[model samples]
Target: MDVIKKKHWWQSDQLKWSVIGLLGLLVGYLVVLMYVQGEYLFAIMTLILSSAGLYIFANRKTYAWRYVYPGLAGMGLFVLFPLVCTIAIAFTNYSSTNQLTFERAQQVLMDRSYQAGKTYNFGLYPTGDEWQLALTDGEMGKHYLSDAFSFGGEQKLQLKETDALPGGERANLRIITQNRLALNQITAVLPDESKVIMSSLRQFSGTRPLYTLADDGLLTNNQSGVKYRQITIAVIISRSTPTEAGVMKNSVLVIPLLSARKTLRASLPTKGSRSLFSLSSSGPWSFRSSLWC
Candidate 1:
């Protein structure tokens, strides 16, 4: 009979420590990245999990990892991450009135300040790597200008003073007005970058503030004559004006700051399916049979 010797857990100490070291490095890297990306909640969670993993592997008696690690990873990725994100989003003012961040709003205001009161009928002419605008003001004949597309800031076009249209063909240019929504949409497309504002091809009246923020943090709605005070960064408490008595009784509506009050309605089950509560950001809640009907 051949005698067999069993190797103790200490014999594999090298392998255990190696695995723990690797895990620590990974978790540390993730925590740093998350913290820098404005995800403090995630970074804290990673730190906690990494500490637990390290402790489990470092000890000889903690066989809990065989069951703990898989569950921890699953819950961290799915349940915990989503829960953290939801909590973070709940605290932000994301409504229409305060839609843009302070930084973005500042940029937009700066860009709007540079508009000149000049309108022109222009046609788009495609160049090799750029687009040229063939513009005519009243009966002032025609002028050609080439432009570079900028993500943010003013669209400053260089007047091709000496160069005329290719073959002098005026029909090649297509007249198009600048879309204001396109400038705002760029933030949605590339949120990390500065907001872009494209100069309009036609001159128009300037924009005015519908509401202004006071030094004490009160926002006054010029149109509705209502005033809103910021209770928290995410929540604003607004008092209704005398004129809005019919639509919004003596009620309060909690709304998302990034969204417009006029454009959204939400349905919630306060009691049961038989009784449905319909709510809008701008008005009082009502109980209805069906949200659609």
Candidate 2:
């Protein structure tokens, strides 16, 4: 009598190799993508985890661990990580002050520059095969020229205001569109250290930072000279659940974050400095964590 044999998923060596190769390529692509997005820490972590996972899945000796790893990774990434972050953030102002984090606020301030003084007009001038940038404050002002820059290809723009711009053969619509993205990244510094950036396709202007952050958690308004000092506020969490007799009021932590009044009008809660945790005023129960000055 002939006996029947069982067929397994990895019975074919070619299939196993193909799967492994595909997974390696996918992991490499994801790692490179994360790196390009400036998520260096996450990229490293992903690389390490992917290497270990591949090793465990491919090796017979660690076959048991292969089954365990997926669950553990899922629990770590999906459950534990979010739980930990949420718990940690509950003690602080994670979503306070118009839900703006410190880093995000800094980026907003950094990008809040405005054109000041005389603005310059920008256009591309031909330089052999490539193109050099030309900037002029007026028709007769000292024309600032930039070195020939290449974008939409291997090389990128590193334009300098020290470089001169002159009227000649201008770049066509095709070339301008090709280099438009790279042009946006270009910021040229003048001899006086003032920055000039392209505001539009044919417009270049002087730009100045509106705010700056200091080492000691101080945010300074460069235009108004207002300094915002970081301070801590106590979070009083009251569990309104009726236990055996009364509700439990648990005080978590003293959170330190943004608590400032800007000149611009916004739809945000009124700024308060009441952070002593000693609530002398009568108010309703609030779950919103405080980051008062």
Candidate 3:
């Protein structure tokens, strides 16, 4: 007869499965973030590898992976990832100035707002349970006031136009300057329907988005009314198949300081009997060529 051994409490199936599920969720979230950040290849690879890893760890029969897990992880992180990244980046049109994705480019253009109207000093005052804002310049031009509104846990405050401040109350210049960060978030609308944004510590002025994005991916300058076209060029060479004098072309975009130039370069490479790769293209643009002799 032999003595029986009991499994430790830490080795319970419930705890193990819970940890595995959490890891799966975390990996899913990271993949989503990577996809959103224009890392499509990395995100897809991470999803495939992580899902396989989690599946192997969760299943009882794959316990043999425990012996090789450390080595596999080390190789994947230090060796495989770099190699995959280099291969993936080789096919993309990624450069220092042309790094922004379409969405990020739109966001950057949208954030640029130009001051349109007069810049004025502002005030913030508390009235009962809410706050009101008052705007005026040293010239004592037409004064502006806001409705009493209470906002919670917000870093920026947008002012709603009110006919008048009930008690005509205004905070001192010291108080207004002290809450400069809160003042920075405020935007007011003018009679002409233009927006007013914080220009400085306490000054507010009318503004409009510098660039306007269109449905067809065109960007127009609000001030100059000049339209900029959005051009997309895609070249995909998924496999290196044997070709009999076939042409492969890639479009090149050379954007100068004030203009954009696109040039197309095509190469007709013939596969000889000796499996020699006679690949050549015009200009200095380079692409990876593989020969499967």
Query: Can you write out model 3's per-residue Cα lDDT over 173-284, one digit (the tens) per residue?
Result: 7766776666666666554455677787667887788887778666667876655544332211222333465654322222211111222222224333212222235433
TM-score per prediction, in order, is: 0.31, 0.39, 0.39
Question: On a 0 to 100 scale, what is the lDDT of residue 107 in model 1?
Answer: 39
> Which digits, one per residue and each the tens of the lDDT, describe model 2 over residues 136-244?
7685476667677665433434445443446486777687677788877777666566667777777778667776767876666677665554433322122223345
* Residue range 1-293, candidate 1, lDDT tens digits: 99888878766768777877888888988888776554667788779877876787677688867578868877987898899878766766544544565445433433433332334445445455444544444454545444534334434344443235544333231333343443333211111221222345342222335666777867665556677654333344465333454443223324433232232222223444322223444333311122221
Clashing pairs in 1: 94-257, 94-258, 95-256, 95-257, 95-258
How does model 1 fare in lDDT? 0.48
- Give the winner by TM-score: 2 or 3: 2
lDDT (CA) per prediction: 0.48, 0.59, 0.59
**C-alpha positional error of residue 29 in candidate 3 after TM-score superposition, expressed in Å:** 36
